[model samples]
Target chain A: MSAIATPLAREPVLSLRGVNKRFGAVQALTDVHIDVAAGEVVALVGDNGAGKSTLVKVIAGVYQPDSGDIRFSGINVTVGGPGEAQALGIATVFQDLALCDNLDVVANLFLGREDLAGGLLNEVKMEKEAWRLLRTLSAKIPSVRIPIAALSGGQRQTVAIARSLVGDPKVVMLDEPTAALGVAQTAEVLNMIERLREHGLGVILISHNMADVQAVADRIVVLRLGRNAAEFRVEEATTDQLVAAITGASDNVVAARAERRRTDGAEAQLEEGNSDG
Target chain B: MADTEQTHTVADDLADERLIRVQGLSGLVHMTWNRLRSGELGSLPVVVGLVVISILFYAMEPRFLSSRSLVSITQFAAPIGIIALGIVLVLLLGQIDLSVGSVSGLAAAGMAVLVVRHGYSELVGIMAALTVGLLIGAVYAVLHNRLGVPSFVFSLAGLLGFQGLLLYVLGRQGTINLPSGSFLVEFTRFKFVTGLTSYVLVLAVVAVFLATQLWGIRTRTRAGLSAPGQGAVLIKVGLLAVGLLVLTWYVNLDRGWSYLWLFFVFLVVVMDLLLRRTRWGRHVFAVGGNEEAARRSGVKVGRIYFTVFASCSMLAAVGGLLAAGLQTSVSQASGTTDTNLTAIAAAVIGGTSLFGGRGSAYSAMLGIIVLQAIQSGLNMVGVDSSVRFMVTGGVLLLAVAIDSVSRRARSSSGRG
Candidate 1:
């Protein structure tokens, strides 16, 4: 049940060690180490500008880190660009979802990597594959034939996740998938993450919502500023500890306010006791 | 597979209670109604407009609906319709190429000069002209893809400059007459698919349509999906066959099916296939819908833009070559008189959206016929060019209004 005892037991499918990135005057990431094992959900949680996004981008190959050892399935490799990353079995679903609204769900699912049967788009094959993928995720949507613009935020998120699976990647990374989702939609996405784990895929979930992270994640990694602040197993992590780790100080604004209220109440009780005596 | 089917009671599409499913023609009507409400008014408005225009013209002139006039409309529609096809492709990307007219004129002028002055073979001249068109498109692609020049601005500059180039190519002669017995003239001016050839073409088209529809149904059924009913498929096939039969009968009454019009239709059909069935076509729509999304999804946005611009110019050249062959001459005024507007307006009037990502090549074919019909009908009624321009302008405005209104409706209805 201990975080360190179990994580080191399995050979990680995707691992990053000593990853460092800098943007001219600002150091975006420093000494970042993340390992996502097969069938494990590792939640990367942080406040704004805490290098969570930078770490995801570096992994997704949008921006190469200055120095890092990235090993996929125990083989050291360099992700040159998005295409190369996809080729190396690393799928990234960005926050925007990057879907064409005018196209159908099946079309969006198999957009760049369309299935062709005689050098022409085999709609039947693609549609069948789309259905199979959705069924695996147990997605609730009216029809894949319907345009994406006709979908709810949750269904759209499901389609985006389903699209990432089309390439059969070893590691799938989702960036704030539940950020713009409603309660039910967020539940659907979290359920989808569980399904992804069931399918034996390593998942890196970058989120700001603590409840969401705690609900589905196996372990939570907190980033403060440009460094890893703390790591907690989901079973043991609390909101207070996570918040403190995210802000890098326990006596920050929220904690200080609570401390003041407690002292004021104790003083008022002492005054009452003296008057009674 | 049988065991897999037991878990789900209905097909994937039929699982939604929101959709009101029906059978046969009622299903089609219901689907169309839903689509219209959601602003998916594809080609319906244009088809209705064409009918209304025909009826109005017939009411005004007794000979407006004559077979002879109908034949003439199809023949005259071919050249500009070809140019309009290119415009449809460009418009699908929500971009414009205002220089199509000038480019067409320049190509025609270039080809005619090569044949008459240089004594080159007509084929050589045509190749050279098409090559020039390709070069112009590449220049546009470079300026657009690299320098980030808006297509409208560069094409507008091309509109004036290419016209000057056409004039310079003609060089004091102002006009060049293509050799009368050349392959280009013979193919464009006098050739036709008469009697058996016409019937065979009509029958072949209908057969292909039926085959494809049946194949689609089979595949959909095998995939355990909700398929279109057989009755609906038959109805569509029957309507197409009847339409083609009627059109062929009318054309045969005059000069049979014109080879030029056949070529135009062939190009339209091919373009349709390319747009609907290829990865490139899908990328085009995606790029048009959301460039950022398309780019992020790993679509080569620059290459798509380049291909679109280049194809547009090439099609414009083909239209110019056809026009030259039909007229037997190329003058300085060759693509200058109403060519640009007619081509662009035909595309818009046919149902291609100016906002992009929502059009087809068939729109060009239908749109050109509509415009040509209006022009011929107006000519028969003795209207001046000034009046014609105003009428066309009004129609263009109406079409754009429909597009914008439907766009808002679609967005409001969550189908944007």
Candidate 2:
């Protein structure tokens, strides 16, 4: 719970204000503002190179923001590195998942923070914990002992998401988790995200799939050309509005196609009426 | 609520109906067969190679299977096997240390010079040599981490430079004989754990293995996970006990098993434990499997590289010292010629993948035996060193080819 009084009614579990990041001549991110309250899923939708990844990296401590403030539970903190970010209860599952394919699921889940008993890895304990974690997420991994390479893409996604929860983080960020997954797998991931929210975690989901975002997110935050374009509650946000925000123009390809189809349908109707007369 | 409760019940079993459940010895056999089909070969190919070689050699020259010949093979294998053990570490990282042979020669040469020429105690000389190994590894790490030099290029450079250093360290003498009375000479050349002591050692190994297996079973059962049957554990332990006893009896017919061989096995076992049972070991495999992923997961990739290189060089140094002690001398020729290739070959033939992240310490043990057995067999069949060299090279090529093929199979089978 947040201790300090703020301008807002209830303090968000994670909040970013006016964040900016520059990579040499390219301003990767500019004036980005985001807030994720506990039990909320905030979908970050953007086109390629739209600073969605850059923002996630900044929060994950892979990159430092040139300017802006990050407040975690009303406390200002600097995440020096990935380890520091984890220590701060901010866990991120990168797009690549960052898993060792040669290792088993249990090993991947407890890679850096292995439980040791008498200076040796306690396999039983780790396996038990892995089972418990997967159960919580409702992951359908057959066996935790199987190497990650043997698992399906959906299973791998489950393992990655499960790994994030190993730290018991207040915030979980997933970058394009369903980008390389199948339809069923993507559905599984969306369900996993819902489970993450139900567990009262503030989730930041970065995805390009409008359907996935609309299905899982409590709110949608659109980024276009490294800047925040628009924000809307999922209940009220239409696909067209979200797409326009993502493409940064109402006359983008998708909109143009739809507009052309509408006109074509009207012309067809007019021709049918003329023929009947 | 009913659906959720049903899912909870499924969770309690730790496996969904969709998962194939293997139970008992039959299940184990079936699973192994599936794994083989999927190209998760493990040490199967190497073990088969060993058996085939033994039968072929025994057919060509009955003397090759004699107790005396076996004893000699074990002795000759230990030094290079120890070096190969280090190479296994580097290989696990999907990196090679070309300088291992040179490092061994240089370290041994340095030790001999210190002990014989500089009038240093044998212990001091040994420690100094190992220190040189550690220092060389650290320097290589700096070049790799800070300068971004690839492991092969710098190690290749070390290969020539250290060999020259070895020759220079030997100076005008070109060779230095280890004193006959020194502990290093005695341990490497003459010591043995024979008679009752050897049997006790075998019993100890079997006992420890059984205890660990039983412990695992108890803990797994308590955690509600499927445990391997007690019958399976007993069968494994029984087989191991019989094999060790037979080997010991055979070796006893000769001058008995050399302490040097024992030492090498001890190192292998210790290394295997470290690689499989410790955090450092886990990180090593992770770094080898995918360096980028390891880095993203917060693994200290640089440090892991450093430690593996350092340990590899140090093990090479140990191998060098043992070789020196066994021969009772260090010469300019020591650790030269095919030494590096031989060590690397031993690792590969032992079923360690050249691609890294898929090997173990036991690979060194098994690989060296295959090699030395070949050498002994070739000699018994009256083949020259020339034939030996070609045969060894051919075997190495075969091993690498198998590795490549299996890797492809693994990927295709979704087990890569």
Candidate 3:
């Protein structure tokens, strides 16, 4: 139990510092610093082209940061590519999910790291493991043998998420998981994220849906214009404050107005309490 | 699409026959119809097409169904089928090998030059020919994998260049007859499994099939997974056993079944297992289905490409040897005329997707048989070669059309 550091109360599983990525004429990311603690859900929210995807891609090792230090479990590490990132116990679920639609769920789940018995795919074992993974996530897949083409978007999402767990990845990053899901499906995904957190794994959720982010995230980190704008405890942050941090500058009018209203309301409540006393 | 349909649980979609479960024969029909509506044709179109073509050809020429004719068809389909097997592998990776024909031709020419012109033994000549195949594939792999050249361009260049090599090997003489008593000629022309051997082989295949299928049922049932019914498995196996026995009986009537035919079947079975049961097979499909996804999964993309190209070229060399043996001569035209396209055509016609990531080894077996049937039927009917080509082109188009339509149906049916 001591060996497994709970993501919520333990040291950060991953830390990024001064990460910058430049693509020819455009600077995709600049000095992006992020910390994802074990057993914690970190929701990363940003506007379109606010370098959210770029930052995530950098961490996933899809793109190398121009100059940055990435530390995993307090040790500085270099994630040269997705494979290396995977080896470092970092799993990424990109926007596309990167699934082979032609393959069955079991095959897709055990695609690269297949358990072999006597030089052949141990199909029985793979299928059993797939079921176990999905069962843990409460994924509503009908059968493991059916091709991905037969599954719905929500089911596919769950399958992809389940696939990420095959190698016991410590850090799971999900990009826009609930973007296209319906009400029930969204709830299901949110529930899965909570389950992942309970397993002592650190979760980095990238989503546009504030309601979703607000529901599952323990901490909200806002990015604007390729840089970290604000970080807040989910318990302390309001919708307006989070939105304001996501949309523009630190001193945005909407957030200021929301703050004034909050202070005035608190003052009025204090005066009423004095009269009652 | 309608939200109600879009919201179907994947369990309901399994009714479309993507994977067999319950409902017996009616369930099977319902599944096939549903799959067709959704455009997930699998190999149904080609299977039905083969049956229809055979019936139509047999009606036109009774001789088309003769034991001798059937045996001949198997022999003819064997070389092309073997080449098509390699084609299916490459096609699964969404790649093509246009140089297969030229590589094969060069091999035959090399074999002839060594055995006839240079007084080399048959074993040495055969080794040299196969080595040529391996080298060609390795070269193709290097150019495509290391240099980042697309396989299409690399193999196309191979088509023209290897033809030059083939011509060079046969310089001053356009043709050379394989010696009558030599191993290459004798084995290709004369070798056949005895009637008893065919019976034994059929029984063994049936026994293996039944045992494996039953074993699977036991495992799945014990694991509490939704296993395909044992009755369905037994029936399928039973029918397969009958088919094999009948095929053996027919071939045995005319000087027994050729070892070449048996050899081809053996390759199919081995390859089938490799693709379905082995890690290498899984990698191939993954690389074919989504290259980026597979790479991210830690599959070595470059090595897979290299090995596949090399294997395809090696198979092409084997096909070339078959062609030389069948004709009893190695000539400039040994592997050139229609060989490149035809091998690929057979694979597509058999139901291997040209777009990749969805096919089986049996596809080559079924595909070559269809093409061979068409050719054999037309030849017996005295159809002109020009007209035959047109008809062949039409059938290929029809097969492609069915595939496209079925795929569209699948996506629209919310199966995507």
Cα lDDT over the full model 1: 0.90
Q: Model 3: what TM-score for its first chain?
A: 0.86
Tens-digit per-residue lDDT, B293-357, candidate 2 = 88877788999989999999999999999999999999999998588989999999999988889
In DockQ terms, which candidate is top? 1
TM-score of each: 0.95, 0.96, 0.89
Q: Give fnat for candidates 1, 2 and onward, in order.
A: 0.68, 0.67, 0.55
Instruction: Report clashes for each candidate as comma-separated counts.
Output: 0, 0, 8
- Model 3, range B14-128, lDDT digits (tens) per residue? 4233345647688888877776767777778888988898899888988998989988898888988989999999999999898889999999899989999999898888889
Error of 3 at B314 (Å): 0.8
lDDT of 1 by residue, B142-175 (tens): 9999999999999999999999999999999798
Name model 3 segments beyond 4 Å from true: A1-9, A18-32, A48-50, A63-69, A248-277, B1-21
lDDT of 3 at B139: 86
Q: Which ten residues in a row have the lowest lDDT in candidate 2 chain B?
A: B3-12
Docking tier of model 1: it is medium
Candidate 2: C-alpha RMSD after superposition = 3.2
- The candidate with the higher DockQ, 1 or 3, is 1
